[model samples]
Target: MLPSIIIVNYKSSRLILDCLHSIYRQGQEEFEVIVVDNSDDEEGRKAISGSYPVVKWIRMEYNAGFARANNAGIRAATGDIILLLNPDTLVEDNAIAECAARLRSSEYVAAGVQLLNTDRSPQITGNYFMTGGLNHLMALPAVGRLIRWLGYRLKVKKTNVASAEGLVEVDWINGAFLMVKRTAIDKAGLLDEDFFLYAEEIEWCSRLRRIGKLCVYGDLHTLHLQGESANDAFGSSGKGYYNLSDRKGYQIMLSGLVRIRKQFGAGWFIFHLAAYLFTVPVYLLVTIIRTLFLQPGRKREWANWWGFSVNVLRICGFVPVILSKKPHFYKVL
Candidate 1:
């Protein structure tokens, strides 16, 4: 069965063109490409469509976010396998076809390949479920280190799991290069529209995990220019390690809260929310102290932590909407 690759475009027209070039260069002619243009860039559509007339373009009236746009593409897909690819990524060699073949032959319901940075270094592709207050605890400096050490001592697989066949069983794979059977998606349902950006894939994987295994082909690789598309949609300052101060970071933290609420229910969600709220002062004090004496140039770091803390509190305002099943756009940008 051929795979239908769905790429959600958000003002990254040039990047999407390069991504398409990489895919077509693979010479794998059995697959179909669907470009869900959230920006509705007529010029980009004309440029891309003019080059690849076979591409199925679905133009959105507004920036519909990742989940909604991909859902639109998925609804239009006719292929047996569906690949949710990022517009900023370039598939290496036969990574797409090989990933599809692996999913078709194995018991895995969904699969992701090894993601690489532009330098070809491996990026984090798969990870275990972030539940049970683990997400909240991991944000704390000391507790996070202790938890990691304990996890290491217990051999708790946090990221990718190694197998003899070069496939790793993971809780969820990055959405940038995820390939899943159309039947599995039919069972698990489409991407939840409530999530405007981040953490939607993890929530979707939570449901997909209930049905079958999810794996990653460790050998297959794809170059993912991480956050390039987001940087295009919402301008970035290009500072900080995670840049949690920016609008993008705010959306990420907020959507993560939503994902916790949706996947684990209200109790765990409340626990995490309280944990985050409680740690706000601690993060603030530490950053303030570090910025004053230890690292003067770390003002940006302090701002990032402060912004993240403020956004966490802001999430409190949206708790009612987060808990409800009602559809809402959680766009921070």
Candidate 2:
């Protein structure tokens, strides 16, 4: 069966075009490409459609975010295999075909390719489900080393699938290059629309795991230009991981709480929420100390952390709204 590649595009027209170019370069692959344009960029649509006349384009009435837009594309896909690919990524050297073939031959329901950074270094493409305790522990400085040591001692499964020797079973695969059989999607249902952005894939993967296995192929590589869309929306952080602007960080934390509540239970949700609340004062203390003696220029870091804490607390008021069955967009910005 041919694969249907679904790419959800926001305002990244140029990036999407580049992604399409990479896909077209893969020789003799009978696949359909669906572009769900959330921003309704007519100019981009014209440019892309002019070059690739076979490309299917779906324009949303408004900015529908990732999960909803991708759901729309999935519904319109004609192929049995569906790939949710990021617009900022470039598939390398038969990666898409190989990944699709791997999924077709294996018993796994869903699979992700190894993601590479812009410099071709391996990016973490798979991860274990986040626990409340691990989330809290990772917040503190120099805690990653301790977690790695403990993880080694405990023989806990590794989180990065790219480093594995072969097809590795994982808790969840990153949405950037996820390929799944249409049957699996039909059984599991579409991604939850409540999540406007981050953590939606994790929540979806949790549900997908209920039916069959999820794995990542270490040899299949895709270069992900991570955070370009995010940098456009929120000012550039100039660093990888853990350095997000106030609004972006707030959205992530808020969505994470929602995911925890839906997947684990209210107990895990409350634990993480309370952990965020508890850290407010701790961050405030650090902010004051840095302002007093340390590099004042670095004060933005603490302020961003404080802003995230404050916004998380603010979400408490909307708990009732979020819990209801009615549709509500969870965007903070």
Candidate 3:
């Protein structure tokens, strides 16, 4: 039997239905698909329940956020392999088959796939490690472009028709189209519920990587539309990260890094914190002006900056707490 593909949806009613139809277009029955809807209401629930009968659907009365929503589906999954896919992506024929086949063949690999933009442009292929030290970078538009440039020069994204040949280890594959083994997902535990939106994949894959290897099959590809980017539980105005989401993502990553550093004694946590502070002015300006990403108005973006700054202050408040009181900060095992 094939793995059960889990798609977490919110406000993606039509897209979810269409995505399910496309998956069937692959003409493969080895896999099952489970869709978890975190729509604020049951409109999507009611509409899809009677309409789509091919798969299992879970309608959540309250929004459970992104990672938690997927965790819900993961727990219900029965496939030896578990595919965490986005609802907006259009899977080309054989995409799912190839990803599953490649991952199954590799003991070290947790997941792998080729992700493309809506326009068929190659998005990052293969996995990557999310760095926490001074050199670790968040792939914002600027950083994304830089990484792509480096990838193109290195010819590392995708090389040939060999689906699994090019990459061996990655920080993390884009959650947009990740295929993992059931054993790996179970070993890694489930997706961390702490991440309501961004960086959850990085955190999840980071743990899986500790166990074995993670990569992407760049030679094959799936089409991800620009409009349907994130399958988030909560909503994004796109102006920037909301106050609550920003606070959660930042603290989640910081908390992870602190735990890791205390064990390794990396001292890079201080360097990373310094980087975040320096980035404060830059990201603050980015948030305030809404320079590049077309989202909300400038005023809305500034509010996001103000929100992030508030969280940073709160995080500083806890540094002494973790150091003096909790003392369990470094214990990863």
Candidate 4:
């Protein structure tokens, strides 16, 4: 086989079906499809598996989060090349083939495809590793906007994928459409299961970097219905739910803490604590101003404020009873 594509479906049966449809439309049979149903949706699984008999469906006992679920698929996959694709994605013709080709041709351990939103707008498909300085700047509202504006103007921005050509090296590619060589997996080891959802790929990329380079292929693109599962879980509580998904926000923060603690150690955790403390007042002020002014996206601003507050508490060793009792937010039903 050319490669084994693994997709973890979390209660997004309809989306996964659409994804599989796209794959079949591509008419590439040199690979296999493995679907890990973390949601354990029996009806959805049966329907999809019956319709797409070739798809390998693994019914999970419960939600195991992104990392472990992917690891399960990775273990079951027999291909020398492993692809971790999101269920909420539509693959373009030859996109996976091109990525697999790039991985085989180059010394790179992993390769990812350009991903776009439904409107065909380019998404942030890849990113540089988060540094303390960059994280601090992004945490401050004023500086963050300025930094983003500068990045947009610089033309070297990560999201400027529409004009990007060929395969470019990157610190890490988003897990939505990541492809990795089997040798790289053997060398770098499986993804850290500590990260339930968000930041898992970033941590895994760090390990891959130790073994080989990671690149983002710009020749092909995939349509990604971003956050479909997360939105279904924690959305529509109020106005402009599209601006922010609380489920994703919480999982990102929790997984981010896990990533920082593991990757950078206690020193960086203290650094993050100091940085969060320094920016809390500014974030609070921004939240109040945005709310009182009835900003167009006040909901998202408030969501960011809430996320920062929760993360600060976590940093201070004060875990809420609910979260303390349940460590992985992504697995919560």
Evaluate model 4: give its lDDT.
0.73
Cα lDDT of model 2 by residue, 1-333, tens digit: 689999988888799899888988776447899999988799999999998888999999988888999999999998888999999899898888888887988899999988989888888898776555354235432333456688889887555554644778898988888898899999999999988888889889988999899998887789999877766665545434454336666666677778777887767766666666666667667667777778666857676766656676787876776555356778765
What's the lDDT for residue 61 in model 1?
A: 87
Off by over 4 Å in 4: 136-143, 146-163, 236-245, 290-311, 318-333
lDDT of each residue in 1-333, candidate 1, tens digit only: 578999998888799899989988878778889999988699999999998898989998888899999999999999999999999898888899888887898899999998888887678788787546373356453335566788789887555433213777888888988888988998999999988898889889989999899988888889999888887666875522255556776787688778888888888888877776776776777777788888887767766776777777787898888778577888887
Flag regions of model 1 displaced more than 4 Å: 130-133, 136-165, 237-241
TM-score of model 4 (CA atoms) = 0.83
The most accurate candidate by TM-score is 1
Model 1 TM-score relative to the real fold: 0.91
Backbone clash pairs in model 3 (N, Cα, C under 3 Å; residues 3+ apart or in different chains), count: 8
Candidate 3 per-residue lDDT, tens place, 1-333, comes to: 667898877788778778777777666767778888876546776666676666788767666666778888988888888888887877876778777877787775466566666666666545433234322433222333454577678665342222344554565677778777888776778876644555567667778877787766666677766334341422332322223335344544455445434423445555555555555577665664563576555575666566656655665655654444344322110
Which scores greater on TM-score, model 1 or model 4?
Answer: 1
Pairs that clash in candidate 2 = none
TM-score of each prediction? 0.91, 0.90, 0.70, 0.83
Best by lDDT: 1
Q: Candidate 2: deviation at residue 56, Å? A: 0.3
lDDT of 4 by residue, 1-333 (tens): 669999998878898899888988877878888999888789888888888888899877878878999999999999989999998899996799877976898899998888888898787776676554244244344435666777668764353233346777887888899999999999899998756777788889889989988888877899888877666765524321122224554455556656666666656755655665666677688778778875755686776677666655654563332234344443322
The C-alpha stretches of model 3 lying farther than 4 A from their native spots are 130-168, 226-270, 281-333
